[model samples]
Every structure is written in structure tokens, then in C-alpha cells.
Target: MSRHALGPEIHAQGTRFHVHSPDADRLWLCLFDAEDRETRLPMARDGKHAWSLDVPGAGEGTRYGIRVDGAYDPGAGLWFDPDKLLLDPYAAAIDRAFVYDPALAAPRGEGADTAPLMPKGVVTAPLPPVAAAPPLFRPGGLIYEVQVRGFTMLHPDIPETQRGTIAALGHPAVIDHLRRLHVSAVELMPVNAWIDERHLGPLGLRNAWGYNPVGWFALDPRLAPGGMAELRGAVAALHEAGIGVILDMVYNHDGESDAWGPTLSLRGLDARSYFRHEPDGRLINDMGTGNSIDCNHPLTQRLILDSLRHFVSAAGVDGFRFDLAPALGRLPTGFDPEAPLLQAMRADPLLSDRILIAEPWDIGPGGYQLGRFDEGWLEWNDRYRDDLRRFWRGDRCTLGSLATRLAGSSDIFGEGSRTRTVNFLAAHDGFTLADVTAYAHRHNEANGEQNRDGHGENFSWNNGVEGASANPAIQAARRRDIKALLGTLFCSRGTIMLTAGDEFGRSQQGNNNAYAQDNAIGWVDWTGRDREMEAYAFALAALRASQPDLQDVGWLTPGDVEWLDEQGQPLTVAQWEDPDRRCLAMRFRRSGLAIFVNGDDRPRSFGGVSVPARTVLPIPADQATA
Candidate 1:
């Protein structure tokens, strides 16, 4: 009903297609037949930068695109040409298996017809009406992050036909695993159709992580082989099992790279308004990807909001985790907590209460907005991740930092009465929990970056061995550290997220940045999983659900949680800052839960004052309790 609804509106008799090209002099609505012949139909502009047309004969399954004639210039960032067939920025369905050709990146003056290589937009059939449901997962719930393709690719119980597809997520084996872990929600990585980076094609590597999104509306065929219906069905199945589905959305940037990249959807249609460019016309590289999207633009903001509504209203996604969220909140002046886009999302009737999480940083100027988001929005606490890793890895002078993190990052999140922290020790971009203790440094040579692609400082210890070792002592120590890390996450006072295979101790051979490793290196090895670690994780999840103090809605104070020394006494300021002390104990005042962590090599004595009684509990270095 609103003018901002700029996509194809499917009806029984015909389809009304709408697009926005502010600078276009002329626009043609082109429809392709089964034989690939194009029917050129002129479109009318509303004189306000909006173009629309209704085709009575063009109903569902109609493949159409737009051809615009306008000023074409690269330096000034006004790249528009009628010759190249441009996709609908709001296309709901695209042809499967989109193939990228280098010719598409060339200037329109090159006279290269990319229509043959371009994927067409299909007019989708009207979806059956369904009632909207309330959100399932809430604050302080366990979120299991998973990549659709890599998660079930090697699953033994899933059928070969369904393996590596969205349908596989609802499989009995997969659902059973989540149920066993007591997972409240599954945060799926990007499902949007994406193009591999231009450089990866030449190097024989593929984009395993779907971070490089090209089509914001259409699902990636490789991940969602059966399209939107399959994704909806999977969400329904997960909901039936009492698990919510949260999608990781990327609106900060697209698959379209810098000046040398392809003229795909927005770049080919209207580059000036779609992307941010400097005074000299050089594109802004805020996302560290080629061109940063100008999200503040009215049309760009409309597209993003419409896409979010579509996912929730049509695809049934329960929530969204915005990747590189600061880019979306940035304005001409600076990042605003009350940015138009963020405000629109929170005020929208369809999305207000849905779970919204932010990976609150970008590579742009002043982009690290760790805990500065609006009160209701939860953030990925990278500080919590680093502090937990450093403390559990035997780094010294970390007790003070670890104490803050264990109390829901009160120093960063401000001890507010809001659910703000999504604590995680490791995520998709870095080494696995197993690799954290089995490899000291990253080994990302497979990414074709000469071993310089991933994080240089991982704070990982190899347990005295560089790689895999047959020494049982080293292996046992690694397992102990893994347990300690998992326990720390569960006992912390906030929501927790665990990467897919981390529960079973799956490793990437120390490849921290495996975004380009599409083969076995990225897939989860289910057969060789560590069953003991899996059981331990399951136990921790059970403990978290059963205990109330671990899921505190607000930040914990000294009155709520007390830090203690090995002798069951309140830790002194000097002892808290001791560089050599690696063992600590935490006792929750109300819950009386005692967590003793010994990061040292040998056994250590731990004491805690629980229930008005000072009790000293001797905890073996191997016994890291949750």
C-alpha cells in the first residue's frame, strides 16, 4: 500500500512491477520468453524517481528485467546504460545457478551483451495467506550458529539428495542434535544469493561463507536448492520443534566490488544513488569490501526495510542478526543510534519485537560500536570472546577482565536492565574451539593468501605441540581447556552462541579464515567428532537451562556475584591483578552456584563462600566445573 513497496506485486490476473531509478532518462520493462527472446515494454515514471508498469499477460513465472538509458560515467559514479539487462533490485525469485562472467564488469561502452550470462527475475505466484506468530526464542537463550551447506554436507544420517541444502536442516539427525544441546534458536548464516569474489574465481576458490551477497531477496540456490518454499518449510519444522530461526543479514555491502568489479544489479541500474562515493567519485570502502552501500539514501533504506519484512512475512524467519551493523547506522555526520534505518526497523509493526542482534562494527571510520546500540538490541561481545580466550589460554593478569565478562560485561554494557550481550568464545570467522588449544597460530595457506589471510593474534596455545599430536597428555590438556571455555560461556550472565561443530570439537586445521575453503576444510566432519566433548556441551546446556542466575536479565553486581581466591576469601586487588595467577573461582550470591576454573598446569585449591558458609573446594586442574 505504501509507495516504498518497490518490488513485483503478483496478482491472479497480472503482475505489477515497480522500480526506482532517480537519474534514468528512459526505462524499458523487458520480458524474456522460454527461447530467451526479449519483449521491450516502455515504463512510465511518476516524475518522482519511481517507475512502474502492470502487465496483464505477464503473470507468475514471467521472467522480466529492466533496461535503463541514462548518463554513463565511472569517475563521477553515474554508471547507467540501457544496453545491459539489469536485475530488479527487489526480485523475489531469480534463476538458479547465477553465473558471473568477467564481461559483466566491463564498461557498457564495451558493447558486451551480458544478457546471456545474467540471471532473470521471475514473477512469483501469490503466497497462501497465513497468520503471523509471536517470537519463539527470547533473551538469554542459547543460539547455535550454523552454515547450511557446511553443516549437513557430510552428515551420515541425511539422505544424499537432501544433503547440503536447506531441507537438510530439518532432518531428524540435525534437529535431534539441536534438541540434545537444548538449543533455543538456530542462527543461520547468510542465505541470500551471492556472487563469489572476482578474485576467487581465478584462484579456484569459492566463497564458502555467504557474506558476499549479490541478490538481497532471492535465496542462494546452492544453499537453498528448493528456494523459498524449502526455507519456509525448514523454519516451520524448526518451529514445530520449539526452535526459532534467526538469519544473518548483510546489507552493509554487496557482491559488487570496487571500480574494477562487475556492473550487476544496483551498479548497472543506478550507481550514484545506490553506493556511497567520495567528492572525487571514488567509492567508500567502509565495509572493507569494494563499495560500501549508501544506506542513508531513501531508496536504499526502503529496499533494506522491504527485504526484512519480506523475510519475516513470507519466509517466516523469527529474527535477524545484522552483519557489520555499524555501516547501516552511519549517516553523513556519523553513526547514530537513532538512525532512520534502525528507527524504521524498530517501529515497523511486523518487526518491532523480533530478536535483533548486531555484529556492531565495520572497517569504516569510528566504526567499532561495541555496546553503544539501542537498549533493546543485543550485540556480539567481542571483548567477552577475547577475554575468555586469553584467560582460559593461560594469559596472565586476566582475572579482572574475566570477572567483568563473567558478569555480563557490565563495564561495556553498562550494568543496564536490558538484554545486551551475546557471549561467544569463537565464531565463524575464526578458529574452532578445538583448534584454539591444538594450534598456536593460524594456518590459512589454503585461502591462496600466502598464509596472511586470517587473524595474526589468536591467543591460542598448542598445548606444547604445533599441530595434531599422538601424545595423550597434550590431547587431554586440550580437552580440559575446551571444557573450561564451554563452561565459561554457559556460566556467564548473558545469551550464548556456539558455532555448529564446536560442540563436537570439529577443527579447520587451524584455518581461522576459512571463508574461501568450500571443500572438506569448511564442512563439518560428523564421523570423527569427539563424543565426550559433545556430551559435556549437552550437560552445560542443561545446567544453563535449569539454573536461573546464569540467565540474568540485567548485568550482575558484586552483590549478585563474588570473585574469590583459592582460599575461599574475597580476592584482594593485588591478587586480582597478579600476572602469575591463572586460577579463579566465582560464586553466585543468590543461586549459590560455584564455578572453579584452574587455568594452571597442575592441580589447584579453590574456595567459595556459598550460602553464608565459606567452603573450600579443591578442584583438580582437569576439573573445570560449570
Candidate 2:
């Protein structure tokens, strides 16, 4: 069962406000004026789980927050405190971004009124919904993962003022770059309003990624100075350029972190229903983010569904990439692909045909569900990422693993008629492609964690020297490896991802987990980018875009394709199991298109074609034999 619509509603005479707080005894509508004067109005209980009020004069641009008073037992998970002014979860816009303050997390009755410290939601008059259209993104196309501020912060062409904002992506330079890469969509990482984690402030660092979101619908004012308008305009521009926009959504958890974390939005209103809890009454941290949203709950499900629809109908975003997606499917027993919320998204009229991608893992038990999602959802295949890296790094027995990945990991997704894998060499969370070949380990000491943060086993290696090397020979070798990685990715059989600056040889020095270094280390250095690497990436994308065989989206069998050795002869069972095998040629029997890979230390010859060391070469002709 659904409750009445939440959030503020603007009418000709006045604005009506509604909220869902089934456990709250009373709720106050806290309205703030231009001079920051506060006015509180009591809301009447409408039905089972709603509290609403109508103000005759309160209309557009009215800044408001919710204050709920109820049981204050933290152990029981009821965190209602009237002093904690909360933003409406459905707040489509906010006056400013949230800043982390210790007072916001002070337990009930300990801290002074937090109204002054928190940002107030700005009431917005809904714009005409963006005209409905099908998503521009499709399977087997490039999904360029992007961090809005970091991606364009250092671009010389963008104006100084708009350099780090979302609107900068709409500029001609950005679109031209996307067009060159043949990007199907740009996945904007967490653009919603977020607060710096409490620990980051003391370290003189902040959350560079907006993963710690507070409100679901409101855009972070830092990324979008003009609020929803900024996002809407950018989406329109990208759509005009034949590119899609996919927002990286975080519904698994809210920024209102742990038991000691802030009482921002969901916590103060209805923590019991919004967040999952154990029998002893502790917050469940399946997402490893302190608190997990109880996505199975009807109220929580409704809130998430409304937010997804809001982005689609109001802002015209093409799709979403769910973060820590296992949390979205977890039931009381375990994660289920057919969980109610997951099914609801596919069945919902507004989202049925939308592009849905899942990160497919978390920190909880049974969280590593690689190919478990239903047929409609494409999953980020870490197997492909790791296998390809191992093969290129000269790991033994990786040739067969590389072949399995190139053929769309049928062993993983054999049940489906087509593969639902999103293959990639590197992503935003790890080392960039350039760093993958140049740094053997993570140097995230700049993150203020004493190099203690980030993954230890990266499966990365230095070509000859670690970090930045002045040796031209070392630099040239790294470039060759990067191009080889790009070639393998583009020639693979499923949809692929290229972290925004990865194609152009962006290096974080050696920082893999750069979620805090918002300075030069995190920003893409456009001026220093390798033009040759950029050209190679563009050419590979063009090839993938032009060829139908690479985009077949089906599982390749022996009849459909053949694997050959360096001499271009069919591989024997013994050769297939050889640990030192370094060359592979996969030819589509129907299209007669072959991709020759040379992972060895020296050049390898395939028929008349000579493939350089650490490279992948494509022969488009029907001459299948050497």
C-alpha cells in the first residue's frame, strides 16, 4: 500500500506539504525566510503514515525542513528529535550543499538546535516534464564513468567559473571529446547533495566523490550551481549530441551514517522503516557504509522509485547505475535477483525500458553476485577486468582466462541467451589505464591514511620503473601496454567501460583510491594527456562502433568463432592448456573478422600481419588462414 504523495505541492492559492513518518508522534514544518528567520507550523495527521500542512502564502522558493518528535532511543533505532531539522527526502532542489558539522550528530538533547548548521530544502515549482524518449544507451556500447568536478576541473577550454560544474560537460569541447570516443553514455558519479564524512574534515580532506549522499533528488549545489536547471540543460545538450546520461545513484545508504553519524534526513524522520536493523536493534551495514536502506520495505521502496522517476521525468536522464547493488536485492534471508524492489524497477511503466546497470557486489556475505542479476540488468564483470589484466601482465595460464572474457564469459552468464557483462580494464574506483601499466601498487598516502587505505593486491605492475619515470624507453613501453589494453577492451564481446581520462593516459601519480584528494591529483590533466594514446583510443572506439561482429551480444561457440596460436593455426587442446602461451587470435567464422593479441615480450607474426609486442591487432579480411 502507498501513502499520499510526499514533498511540497504548489497550487494557485497556496502550497500543501506532506511527509511520511509512521512512528513519529508529531512533525513540524520548519520554514526559513530570506534573512534566515525560522517559523514552525504543526502538521496534522492525515492518515496512517502521513503528516501534512497547507500554508496559504508559502509558495515557490520557500526554504523548509522537517522536524520530527518521537521516541529517542538509539538502541531501538528510533532517532526522532525536533531540534534536528531534516531535509525532505523528495526535495528536488536545495539552497546549498550540506557541510558536515559535529553538532548535527550530537545525540538527542545534547546538541543545540541544528537548524542553523543544516541546509534547508528549497521548494521548487515543477518544470514541464522532459518529453519522453527512449534511452540513447544500448548494450555493448561504451559507458564512460565520470566524476563531474574532477572530469572537467582542469580543462583549458572551459571557462574558469564553469570549469568544475556539471554545465561544463555541455560545452562544445566536452561533447567533441565524447563524440571522438564514440561514447554511448557518460555515467556521472554521485551528483546528489552529500556531506563530507565526519573524519575527512579533521584530515584537511573532503569527499571528492559524492557517494555519501544526504537527499535523493536534490543536486549537489557545488556540482550544479543552478540546481536542477543545470542538470536538465546538460542532459538536453548530451541528448542532442546523440549521447546518453547515466547518474551513479546511491540508494544503498544515506549520508546519515552510523549510530554516531548525523541526523540529516532519513534518520530523523523514519530510521526504523528506511534503514535495515538487526534483532538486537543495531543498524545493518550490508553496504559497508554504516547503514543500509531497507529497500525491501514498502515505504523505502516507494521513496527510491519516486526518486528514480523524478530523475527520468523531471531531469530527462537516460538511466542509472546502482552503487553497491547487492543491497538493492537483499531479502531477509539473502540477496535475490527477483527481489520486489528490483522487479518493481523493471515492471514500473516509467523505467521498464531504461538502461539499468549494477555494480554487483558489496562487503556482506554472498555479496559477490557477478552474473546473478535478471536478464534486463547488465553487471560490471570484474572477472573480465582481472583476467585481461593478468594476461597482459604475463601471468601463467591467463590465455584461456582471457579467451573466456573475450567471448563474453559464457561460463558466468550461460543461462542467458546473450551476455550481460560490462567489461573494462580500469574504473573510477581503481588505477587508471596508464597507472595500471606504470605502478605496481597503490600510493594513496596522499589520502591522509598513511598509505593504509585502498586495495593491496591491485594485480598491477610497473613496465620497468614505478611511478613517473623520465626514461623514454620505459614511457614508450607503458604506452604500448595501454594501447594493447584498449585494443583488447574494444575488441571484447560485451558492453565496455572507459573511465573518462583513462583513454588519454590520465595518471593519479599512483593513487588508486583517490576519493579524498580533490586537488590536482584527482582532476584530469588535459594539457599533459598523451595525444597518441588518445588517437589510438578514438580509433578503437570507431572500429568497435563500425563492426557488427564485436556488438553481436551473443555467447560465442566453437562453430561461431575459433582461437588460433601466433602462427594462425587452430589451437590444440594441449596448446590451450599451456601456461606460457602468449599469442591468441579470435576469428568470427561468420564475419571472418580476427583480433590478433600479442602479450609476449616480442613481436608475433599472424599470417602476413606482424603484431608488435604487448599489442592487439585486428585483421578485417576473410583470409582466416596464415
Candidate 3:
């Protein structure tokens, strides 16, 4: 059987189910009816390490699962138990979403049949493929990172029935917001089928972010009740609005976490073949998840490629943002830039032109592979996030660093002709722009870990009082700091990213790691938004979009850009080395656009431009090129 053909294939005659299990002693295909009655049939060995069975008259709408029988040897990495019904890795749809249950994790024969506790794969007929088109997005464009459910859940304009679903993204209000921000694309966080971590249940929390996935092709029913059709419609609407869609995919690990997790999928099918393990049989924790996918394995590669193609052809997404992307290139020797999987993706005709972005790091050895991916890829630049935050927070010795980031980080990207940096002030995992200026430390006591679950050093500071201060003076200072940060981000080179709700002063109450707070803490509060800040962000975006010089991804050269001091002359060596200095002007000689920055507490004038304290001033368009 073909590698990509491991899933069920339907024809007029019947449906043929194919499963790859090289080590199973036996295998069976279990079919169920509307009443939840099951009929099990033995599968005949098809090839060297696979099984197959043909059921006549069975076609779309069939609910089924696979049962693998093998010696339960944990030390040898063989975990097969027929009692645990497993989901097909290629399942496009499941009857229901997965929920945590202790019975699902019981050892072989120790627990009752798990079929009652697992979701059954539903057979689906393929939808008409979306007509391919060139992606509307490109390097140097703005990407809006969106948490589908969190972003739409509490949106007042969206009807309550459709509020939290993928369909709600197509609502007029949502599109209007993206348009105002001049977003080139919306990066939807993981919408694939996933199970919450076992620990979250006891704490009365659930995973709001869909990072822990089980089936690659299965769209989480909670997010899209209408299945792939819902995603297709949303993508079509976004495309109509001239905005592309980018799905964030997690291929590093499955929800079958650690040794104590459930066996809902790959682990029950073929553990050794599906996961990376040591010679002694322990699973590798490269992704910080219980186990990492064996990307080097051909079977794993086939599933990943098929999943990507499915979204592109079936749902019309422009591209994908890989979570913990180093896992895609990890091999037995180490992380190789030319790893087979990465090479295959670039070489594949279906995905070659689609935008490929890498998170660029994981918890594994040599995992921080910044600027290591090939020229076809763009990477998330955390260095840009930190150094800029420090500079705007009045840190010493940040003037030079600020210049470097604004010039697209020549030190990191090697001063290339074009940069692959995705600049940002804050992301989904950290403090919001408002929180960054209002909290010196994290307030994650609500996570039930006593504030130990989030980052200890966030490079943050409270303007005067930490979190929710009613002092009018303090509020004014916080607003100034946020505007300064936004100015720095919009003025920076290369592709930029802004997390959802950061523009309108959304806050997680200093909960940097609110992955489990699926409630108001994680949702974007549309009602409490600041109109002034929102308008400021929109104006910044308009300015950035209108300025051709700012959109260029290439490194700014001495002939194209000039750095000036308060005297309106080129910055002297001493001034460049002055750690206390916080005022300078970056003049784009080509377009004569000058961005004057004042990082000090006192207002200052640069070359006769009176810039307020902690503000970035862009010379008016009328006199910019004069």
C-alpha cells in the first residue's frame, strides 16, 4: 500500500481500510452503527508491516476504529492493547471531542474496553478541492496571530450561537478589525483534534491552546462543529477580504503524553515506529510533551505531508506556522537542516509556494536553531521581542540594540539582502503590551502552581502600581509606554506580528501563561477596549502600509538610512557608545522619512522635531520627502 494511502479509501464497490502496524500480532477493524453497536472483523495482512480489509457496501458516514493486539512490553517500546480502541492517524473527522478519563490510560487488561471512552473515526467524502491561488501574503507583511475560540468567544458583534466557532471568523466585525490593522494574514492557532493534559482536569482547567494534538487530519469538533466545511467557508471569506489564512500545526508530539497518558492514537497503533525512542526503549522528550513524533520515519513523514495537503487542497489555507519546528528536522545524528521531512515539504509541489514559518526552537539539544532554516523559511524572532522591550522600558545600553532591531537585526540574519525575521512586541505565550508596562512580575497564582508555571524574568515593569491601578497619572504613563512599543514594532523592518487584542489594550491580568484559562482571562475582551489606542494602532498600520520604504525587507544601508543625534548631525562615536542617551533620529534617505524616538522621561527634540517622552514621531507625509 502507498504510504499516504494508509487511511480508508472508498469506492463504488465498498470501502477498503488500510492500517500500518509492523509489530502487531493481530489487527481488527471495528465498525459501529448509530446506536453505538460494534461489529469487529479480522484484517488480513496486506504487506510487510500492514493490514487491510474490504467491507462491501460500506462508504461515507461509516464510524470505525482500529484495534491492535501485541505483547504489551513497555521496556521494548511495544504498547499494543486490543482493549484500547485507537483513532486513525489520518482520520479526517471524529464523532466527538476527546475528554480526559482515567480508564483511557489503564494498562493492558487492567482496564475495561476503552471503545466506550474513545471517539470513533467517521468516514468522510472528500470535498471539491479549492482552486489554488497565489498567497496574498509575502515577506514584510503583518501577520495577526489569532486564537480562534478565544478571539471569537466573547465578541459581542458575533451571534452567541456562532461566537466560539471557526465560522464566526467570517463575521463582518472580525474582518473589519483585521482590515483596520492591515493584516496580511490571520495565523489560526492549533485547531486540530487534541486532548487536554491530565493535570488540567483536577485543577478545573482545560487547554485553551490546541498544542496537544492526537489526530493530524481531524479538526477539533469543538472549534468547527460543521467540520472541514466550516474552515473552508472561513478561509474563502478571509480570501475574499484579501486576507490569507495560515494554520499553526503541531507535529512534534501527540496528546498521548508521557508514560502515564492515554492510548487513544499512535501509541496503541505502533509505538516504536510512531515515536522516537532510545535504544533502551524510553521515549524522547524533545518537545517537552510526553513524547516526540519520529519525523525521520517514513510513515510519520507521510502523515505530516498528507495533513498539510489536506488543508491546502480542502480548506484553501495559504500556509502553515510550525510549532517547535526543530522537530521537523531532527534525525538520529542530530538536528539537520537538510533533514528528509523539511526537504520533502519544500520539494513537494503542493506546499512549495506556501509560506513556511518556523517557531525555530524546542527543548531538545541544539534546539535553538535561529537563522538555521533554509532561505525558503521565515522564523519567529524572540530576540526582537526582548531587546525592544528592554530599550523602551528605559534600560541602559539599549540605543544601539534598538537601532539593530529597527534595521531588521543585521547581526542575527547576517545583513542579508532580505530578512526572514518576524518582529513583535508580545506573543500568545507572554505578557500583553498593556501587562508588560503594568506588571513587574507574573501573576499566575490562578494556574494552581503558585505562580511557578510562567517565566520568572519577563523583562517587565509596573508604571507605578502593579496591575489594575486606578491612579490617573499611572494610567497616563502606561498608555505612553504602550504607544512607544507599538511605534517601535510598526517602524521595524521585515515581517511583523501582533497578537490578537494587543492593539486595543487587552490584558490577561498579568497571566503570561493562560493556556489553561479558556474563560474571560484568555478571551479577547471586546467591550473593554481602548478606542484611543486602537485608533493609534490603526494609524500606525496605515502609515506603515503607505510607506514603501518601511515595507522593504532588505537591510537598511548607510546610503539609505542616517542616524542623527539631537544636534541634527550624524551620531558621534561617543554618543553611540553613551548608555545614558535615549534620543536619536533614524532618517530614511530614500523616502526622507524620519522616525524620532525618545526613550527618556523628559520630552526632547530631535533635529527640530519635538517628540514627546517615550514616543516615536514619524515626520508628516507632506514634509517627509521634502
Candidate 4:
């Protein structure tokens, strides 16, 4: 038996499986039947660092784990405790969570005193039958980014056990809200199996956002209380509600982290081969983490492709958004558009119709390849976020930039389908919509990294007061600004992604970077809703759903949109270039819907200067047309 024959492969029946631990003096394959009875099977030593075992009638659904013999050196990144059974990296499903055990920190077979503190990996039953594929959604799809845990964790209407699990997202209450929101896709934060940072673990904090990925092929046991069955059910429910699920995947680095990080999985198996190491054998730190994965390697590429295929064929996932996507495209001469991974994805039969999105940047050299991706892919538009923030905050000389962004950032994305731009104002990484207007600076003392962790160039305003205040004028101004931002987001000619809880004015108490705060500081406080915010959120949702022109998937011609000045006349050179001139307008007609946006802070009105006189004005979906 070898590592290749352990899991469910196309030719899994009657296959022998084995694992090789070259550094270990001894190793044993622990196999279990469907009844959870374990048997210690001896492994035969094959030449050149290989071990093998044959298990008859041990196909899919048979649970298995391994025990490796080695020293427990914390400084050298070897944490091998035979007593603490380790999981197979290729396990189809994990049945239980890892409990904190201090004994796991000690060397194995030394003393009984260190036995009780070690965490043990529990074997899971075979995976359930693959679910049927959901109805296919097209590109130019509107995605609402959300956290599976936070969406239902505090919802008063959801059941207790179902709360914060994948099954809960499919509840009628949740689906109804999504239908009302009218987004075609729900881009979930990283649900791939991940571990909280060791620093956060000691502080009793967790990585609530799930960006740190440990296993790309497995679902996080934390999010699937009922196991893979529950995840499948959630996906089915989303399909029933006409919404698709897009997973945010991390491929730039593994959870093994830096030189001093844990080696529970891949790095321990093949350190020199799995990760990119420097000339002196030091791990490459391109991801700002301890180690960057060697995506250029053929085996590594296969693993990624296998993981993606598993998610689509087994888990019923509809799409994927790659985190720090530039790392996936990095070759010898910077980011290569024809990287094997990207090309395989485009050519793969299973992934051809799926929605592909890229974060488009990393910490590596020559990383910001914004519009350099292929035509089939969409990119998270950071330019749209910055320019929109600047325009609304009254930044000088931003009118030109704002116009370019509002028209789909043609400067960055050249000539392509308008849907290539995934327009967003605030994402999970930075300030929430409320914080963008309510905090002038980041206050990340809650993250336990002092105030030095999050980004400093926020381009935010306090509306005359930082944080929260009871001042009526400031509060009113904040509400108006929020409405304007939402209006701009929905009116823009591209796919829109609204962060969850932003519609109700969710805030993190000025903690712009609360990545490690698993507590209420990062949870959505549904109790904080005000009448104005609630009404505006509903109105914005309704408007986005009702406007065909705003949601058009086609590209816009020069004559399709006309820029206007404050006095209803065409924009002049002085107005377009003036640093002080913040007022701007865009009028477009498509798919029987007309859209007009006034980006100025002050109130301005427009008349019938271009369109048909008897054309009907589009009303909100929940409102009646006059």
C-alpha cells in the first residue's frame, strides 16, 4: 500500500495503500472498518524510502489514519507524536474537531505523563454520494460576499444546532432574505479546512474569516456540523432559491506557515518538494506567511487541480474566488497569463462553466497584475473601491478617476465584457461600509498586535466625529453617504459584490483589521439596525433587482452613456479636470431601463435632455411604478 491508493480514486477497488516516513524509525498504518474497530496493520518496506500494505475490501467509506515515529523538536518544525494519531492529507472527510491537548507538545513513547495532553485525529466514515449539479448561472453575476458562521450565528429566527453551520444557510428565512437581495451568487469566505494562527490560539481568539487554509480538498469541520451531508444540503437549498455558492480559496500558502510553524500535513511529508525554498534551503515567504507553496511544480499543480475538481464534482460548489491569485500566476518572468493552473482551469470540462474570480495581487515581486487575467475571469476591482471612496469623501482631482471607475475602469480592463470587473466598495479585509464613513483611522488594538497591524491609508472620514456619536448632523450625514455609495455600487456597469452586514450598517467598533477577533467584534450585530439604514438597505436591494440596464452583461459603447454637468449640459474640459469639481453624472439606456447617477455631495437635478419623453422610469422591485 502507498499514499496514492488510500482514498477514493477512479480505480480504488482492490488497491494497496502505503505511506513513507523516511525520517521516522518506524511507522504503522491504522485501519478501521465501518464499525470504528481499528486494526494495526504492519507495513512492508519497499526500496528507496517506501512502505506498502494491502487491505482487502477496504475501498471508500473505510476510515484510516497513520502513526509515525520521530522526534518532537518544536524549533526545527518536527512535531511527531505517535501517540497523537495524525490524519492522512488525502482523507475524504474528517469526522471530528481537534481538541487542545498540551501532551501533543511532547516527544512520543518517552513517558506516560505526556499522554493526556495530545490531540488525536478521529477517522471519518466514507463520503456520501455526490450531489447533483445545480442550475448553471452566467457571468456578470452579482455576488454577495458573506461568512457562513456569522450569517446565521446570531440570527434570532434560526434554530440552535443549525446555527453557523452550512445547513443553516439554506433555511427558508436565509433564502428569503437572499432572494430579496436578488444576488445571483453568494461568495463565501474560505470554508476550506483551516487552522487558527498559533498566536491567536494562545490568545483565545480564532480566525473567524477563514482565509488561512490548511487543506484545500477538505471542508472545514467547524462549518459542517452534520458533515458533508449538511454542506450538500446547503448547496441544494441555495440552488432552489436561484442563488449559487462561490468558495474563496487560498492557494498561495499552506497552513504550515513559516520556518517555526506546525508540520501537521504537507510540509512534513515533503518539505523540499512541496514548498518553494531559497538557495540556503530557507522557505520562500512570498505570501507574507512563513512558506509559499511551489505552484510551478507539476505534482503541486496536480494537487490543486484535484482539490478544485473534488469541490466541484463532490461538494457541488458552483464557483471559486482565488485569494492572492497573483501567486498562482507567478512564473520566472513575473505573472504569466498562460500559467498551467489557469489554463487547466479554463480547459477543464468540470470548471469551464464555473465563475472564476481573482484577487489579482500578492506580496511577491511584480504581483499587482490587475487586468492581466484571461477574458473568462473576473477580478476584484481595488481601483473601484479606492476611487469610489475618494469621490464620496470629497478628494480633489478624483473626478476623472471616478468617471473611469463608474464606467467599469476601462483604463485598467482595456476592452472586454463589462462583467470582467467585480465592483466592490468594502470587502472583509478592510473597513466595513459604516466604518469607511465613521472612522478616520484604524483602531486595531483589539487584534492583540498593538495598533500596528492593519493598513493605515484608509481614505476614510469621520463625518466630523470619529467612531460613534449621538450628534444628529453627523449621523444624518453618515446615512446619506452610505446611501450614495450603495447607489453607485448598484449603478456601476459590472458585477457588484456587497459585503454581508454592510446593508444594515455593520461596524467592527473601529477595528478595521479584526482578522483574529472571533468574538462579537467581528460578528454581525443584527440588533444594531436603525429605521433609516433598514429602509435604505431594502430600497437599494429592490432597486438593484429591478433595473435591467444596471445589471446588463454586455459592454457599453461611447454613445451608450453620456456624462453630464451640474446644469444638465455635457461635461466640459474645466469641469472634467477641475480638482474642486466633485459633481458628475452618467446616463445610460439598456435593456429597457434607464440609469442616472449624481456623484456630487450636494443635491442636483436633471431633466429630459437626451432620452425619449414618454419612457417609464424604473421603480424599486418592491415599489409600484407610477
Question: Please, what is the TM-score per model?
Answer: 0.95, 0.98, 0.98, 0.87
Candidate 3 local lDDT, residue 427? 89
Q: Over the stretch 139-171, how does candidate 1's per-residue lDDT look in tens digits?
A: 888999998899988999999999899999999
Candidate achieving higher lDDT, 2 or 4 = 2
Across 427-538, the per-residue lDDT of candidate 4 in tens digits comes to: 9999999899999999999888879988898888998999999999888888777777877787777688998888878889888887887778787776666656767666
**Which residue pairs collide in model 4, if any?**
1-17, 1-18, 1-52, 1-53, 2-17, 2-18, 61-126, 101-117, 103-117, 258-290
Better of 2 and 4 by TM-score: 2
- In model 2, which residue pairs have backbone atoms overlapping below 3 Å? none
lDDT of 2 by residue, 87-141 (tens): 9998889898898999999988899999999999988998789998999998878
Task: List per-prediction Cα lDDT, in the order shown.
Answer: 0.84, 0.90, 0.90, 0.71
Off by over 4 Å in 3: 1-4, 415-419, 624-626
Candidate 3: give its CA RMSD in angstroms. Answer: 1.4
Q: Model 1, 319: alpha-carbon shift in Å?
A: 1.0
Task: Name model 1 segments beyond 4 Å from true.
Answer: 1-4, 415-419, 607-626
TM-score: model 2 vs. ground truth: 0.98
TM-score of model number 4? 0.87
- Predict model 1's lDDT versus the native: 0.84
Q: How many residue pairs of model 3 clash at the backbone?
A: 1
